[model samples]
Target: MQALEERDYFTDYEILKDPYAFFEAVRSHGPVYQPPGRDYLIVTGFAETLEVLKNSADFSAIIGVQGASAPLPFEPSGSDISEQVEAHRDRILGGDLLVNYDDDLHTKTRALLNRLFTPSRLKANERFIDEYSDEIARQMIARGGCELMRDVATPFVTLVIADLLGVPADDRQHFMNVIDAAPPPGSLNTEENDFRGENHPLTVMGGFFARYILERRANPREDILNEFAHSTYPDGSVPELEELVKMAAFLFGAGQDTSAKLLGNSIRYITDQPGLQDQLRADPSLIPQLLEEVLRLEGSTKQTARLARRDTRIGDRAVPAGTKILVALSAANRDGERWEEPNAFALNRPKIKEHLAFGRGKHVCAGAPLARVEVRIILEKFLAYTSNIDLDEAKHGPRGNRDLNYDPSFIVRGLTELHVKFTPAEGVDLSQASSQAETAQ
Candidate 1:
């Protein structure tokens, strides 16, 4: 077993492409070690990963080299660079949003978000999620087979968020197009090409959402946007129009891609393993546990980066102030030290809930509960409407590179395309399943 310091981090494209091997390598090493180039401390063990996430005082998310000017990949040139970067950073970190802030600011924002995502509210939206999921499932069943990622997951989550935000039906297509144009992580080479194409969707969506907030301010509607428009600070002053727009952009941008990945990856996993699908079909009540297991085995997010605020020790490894730390959540979930069988997909795993799929600590995902609901709805609808689902083995690509490129993103993990076939449940009604089972009992 080699120490983490001995292993190559960046050049190992295979690590990014298929992280299961990387997870094994990390487990063999100690919990934490600085990768080559000394760019960041990579924490792979579950305990250490949790420690870094929970300890905000010792670590800060303020992107800088030793708290100095951090060299960003997207930094603009000329005199406008500083202003542009500052503006972007402010939009990302200055707000009381959970992702950007720590300590008191995170607490306040989390509290506000908690109120919006309460059990009652989630229950209320159950029917809405079910309706949308059923519609998508019906379409897939009708088609006999389809590309799961683009055709189903993408549109399903996009519309769900749009509907929840009360985006006008007429503008949904335009909204989706704008979102699709936005740069995804791991596509830095294509970033310039995308920027040259049209007004960046981030800017357009920000402007449109800001205008919507203003309209809601004049005539409040019963929607999330209206609530956001009217939401205020502790002093009772509403967030500025720009802030509201940024918030909307954050919600849409954050929610759309991640959820799509979750749906796509989970579906792929189930289809590839018929036994798991059969187990799920046998006991629908185990959906929650099964979902957790799937997320742990094939989570969307792989790693997150943080900056060391002070000279800190992570699992006996010394990290200097301003050092960047990459917490590999996906690796942590598969740490051999933590789980009895770390790599295998076990629907019955007792500790499935312990996975870091939604992350941990102050910056944990705000949309986790909603995402879980969406996934559950889709799975239920899929099982109910389809008799048998399987990956098209003929369509499977070579041994090394699969047909679907797992988006080359360290922050998120998911299939680029998932091809599967299913036998549609015709003549057999879903409502009849319960009656037949009862009769058997």
Candidate 2:
């Protein structure tokens, strides 16, 4: 291969398949190195990435989703362009997103989200997740083979989060129908002139949430949606209807996409190593450790964008206000300086949770607990239901020359689809599992 540094990380499609090598090529220049000819900075250093994620004051998330692909609405005015950003926030793509808000607004809007992902809430939702995972597992077993992403992960994740948030059972099919037709979360290209804005899943799902929020406010119910509808900020002021809808929709979209991708990543790695696969099947307790390693090695999110809110120094490089910075989480996670064998997947890596995959500080993925439980429970189910799992050789081709395709997105890194074949475990009783589920209820 030619010098990885010579490739344009943004526009080059082939580089997306394996950007880590490119990241390493850049890291050799220093973690905080600016690519030659690029107008923005990309942070690959472990510590520097955390520094950017932690100090939200100096790094604005206004470009959090769009990244350097979409330009700012207005030019930087001075040493600190905070006011200039606010003045044109409405015109900036993704500026209104919960992930894009900064400082006080971010803190406040994020506060209402606590009720959704709390330990108590997640615990209460576990029984449903368990049943759903088992339900999907049984289906996979009956089929003997499956398209993992479409047939399994996507629907499995979507329904699980919707159920947790108290979307009425009758409305779930409608939710799926709407979501099935829209762009995968984190796949939007706002830079396109003719982008189909109507096709965003959030726009349709937000309407359903709007109706539910209104109904809940008029007659507070005993469900999670009631709590969600009535959640307030630190000052106890109620957020507007629009804000509540965005929060709920954002939570559902973000959680579903990342969790499903994590599941896909987990299965691919586990099955790729037969020893690791056998270890997981024999000792289910190691699933959690496997998850942590998976998140560190092949996280669902590749990178998130940050705008320098003021002139600041990241390591040796000076980042000016308005300069867009791509917080290369994948690169930071695999920084050789931080890990002994950075590219290798080591299940027992020390301080495993320290990776910047879910980001850090206030903007850390709020739905993370739910995501963990979702991926974990489903993985446990897959193992329980199958005697052995193998990549469908016909679909992906022979081991060395596989044809698995990653989603062509600028932000998230995930498979476009995964086809797997499994042998049903002998003596595993799905009927008994269903009976136990009914008995518990």
Candidate 3:
């Protein structure tokens, strides 16, 4: 009914307000689409999205530059950006993180990461996750209600990640403040803040981590940061301090930010739907499935950018080298051909764990396992302490029919704020809850 440009999804505020229908419209058109005036190709179908992700040789992720976690806008510059990108990528040790590398280099970097995220460290971190989740839930219940994003999800995620990375308790508040001040990844605000001198959250975070990296080297500890400080590539070459700082800072931001979005969205969804909330509280074991359904139906990450290295055909469309392609992870997760009643959030949905919420192939999210553990613990703690959860209609709109307000950005799908009220279970006390949490563990 409308022209393609008329339905411009990314920049159009109205479409972004409720993006699923627009995503479905894009999928219905074809697997690969080049919208009017936009040079980049959008891969929407599940199969097509997989093809691009799996075959990095055909579609290179080496976009010639790096910064925050968001994808750069797809507009082509006449001059080659490769040289500048090369300089950035080649700036050894922590200079180029996981996302910037491909092929052999990507593999090597990933191997080093694997060393850092050992199974034992992850298991040990679960104790801290439980402690952080319980403390945050206690505060939320005491407040009676809160803007879930700011009060609970954000701080909960930030603390767990900080503890995991061995960030000092005294400095934890500063780290939280820094992350809060930083704009969501890929936002223009990052650039504006950087231009204003010394205020950019990423820059501050980089400096903090850089100092910590040096400290960890001088006085090694049993934390992951120390592991990174002492790590070497397969060839036994040590990464530069700058390189280590860049990677650690990126992880700190990316880890907390995306998990907060996921946890907030999951809690808001269940709380908004009373039946689902009750179902989950009655049988708390269902939370893992509930989270999987959340990931499938509405994931935090929506899209990723890739460049075509050579002539490539996705379905029927032929793409030339250097063409930037937008792989729609959100759209692919809802493809009807692959998922039954794909739009419905079914807790028992079969094979739902296979969803592409965390991209596919080599560049899949490194923090996915940690994110799962964090959200799962938060949900469990909330259920243990609260009898009921409901929307704070006075602050957010009408009680039963309020629309969920989401951030107006293509890179991350999350709420700007989610006000909610929690009803504590009868006879529930913070001390008792903490004891029960320990016993359960």
Clashing pairs in 2: none
Better of 2 and 3 by TM-score: 2
Q: Provide the overall lDDT of each model, using Cα atoms, as 2-decimal numbers.
A: 0.68, 0.82, 0.74
Global CA lDDT of candidate 1, please?
0.68
**Model 3 segments more than 4 A misplaced:** 1-6, 64-95, 188-197, 431-441
TM-score of 2: 0.94
Q: Which candidate is the best by lDDT?
A: 2
- Each candidate structure's count of clashing pairs: 1, 0, 4
Selected candidate, larger lDDT, 1 vs 3: 3
Query: Which of candidates 2 and 3 is the stronger one according to lDDT?
Result: 2
For each candidate in turn, the TM-score is: 0.84, 0.94, 0.89
Superior candidate under TM-score, 1 versus 3? 3
Q: Give the range of the ten consecutive residues with the poorest summed lDDT in model 1.
A: 432-441
Give the per-residue lDDT of model 1 (tens digit) for 125-201: 77778876776676676668887876777777777777777777667677777666554544323342232234655
